[model samples]
Target: MQTCEVETIIQAAMPEADIDVSGEECNFTVAIISERFEGQNLMQRQKGVLALFEEPLKTGRLHALTIKAFTPAQYAEMQNTFLVQLES
Candidate 1:
């Protein structure tokens, strides 16, 4: 699946997220920022994302995926931000 479509599925689950996805079209490197991730541990946050793609992964529609997930507060601390690029 295209990263945009994958991102859309994730966004449906976590509407506040700002997501950037790139890779070999199927394999993906994803960066996500969302308030829903706040206070959640790394495993939980990753699980939330993985849950969204369970079927795709299981069905082999997606080959591999790497994810970087962050809470809005943590994302704000990033020296370079993704949301600003999206807004513009």
Candidate 2:
């Protein structure tokens, strides 16, 4: 599927989210940061996002989807961790 279509699907569900979709054809990696994930566990967050692409995934329009979903604070922390590791 096209990247824009994948992005549009996710964005429609989480209007307040910051969504990033990369890769091509039927494979994609998605990173979503939103306040909506604040109290949810990792499974809950990932499941909710994956659910948005269920139809596409089932139909093979999306073959592989790697999801990285986080709250704003979590994304900030993850970025810091990666930066620290690079510096070390």
Candidate 3:
């Protein structure tokens, strides 16, 4: 997926989120910071975010994906070192 599309999708789902999307073409790396993730675990966070691209992923419109999601506080503490990892 394109960077703008990836970013837009995430932004739509989590309007208050701070999202960073990188990589090229169909492969991407996304870091999402939101208060919505405050009480969610890593898998829960992954599910919620990945759901936004279910159709694209299934249709092959989106290829590889690397997602790291965290609450604002967590991101502040681990900005240089991700606390979790989820890949698709």
lDDT per prediction? 0.85, 0.92, 0.90
Task: Please identify which of the two predictions, 1 or 2, would achieve the higher TM-score against the true structure.
Answer: 2
TM-score of candidate 2 on Cα atoms, chains taken together: 0.89
Question: What is the Cα-based lDDT of residue 15 in candidate 2?
Answer: 94
Distance from true location, Cα of 10 in model 3, Å: 0.5
Residues 1-88, candidate 1: write the lDDT tens digits: 8978888988898887798988766799899988888889999988878989999999998988898998877877674567667678
What is the per-residue lDDT of model 3 for residues 4-51, given as tens digits with 9 covering 90 to 100? 999999998899999999999889999998999998999999999889
Ranking by TM-score: 2, 3, 1
lDDT of 2: 0.92
lDDT of 2 at 47: 92
| lDDT for each residue of candidate 2 in 2-85, tens digit (9 for 90 to 100) | 989989998999999999999999999999999999999989988998898889989998999898889999999999999999
All predictions: root-mean-square deviation over Cα? 5.2, 1.3, 6.5
Better of 1 and 3 by TM-score: 3
Choose the strongest candidate by lDDT.
2
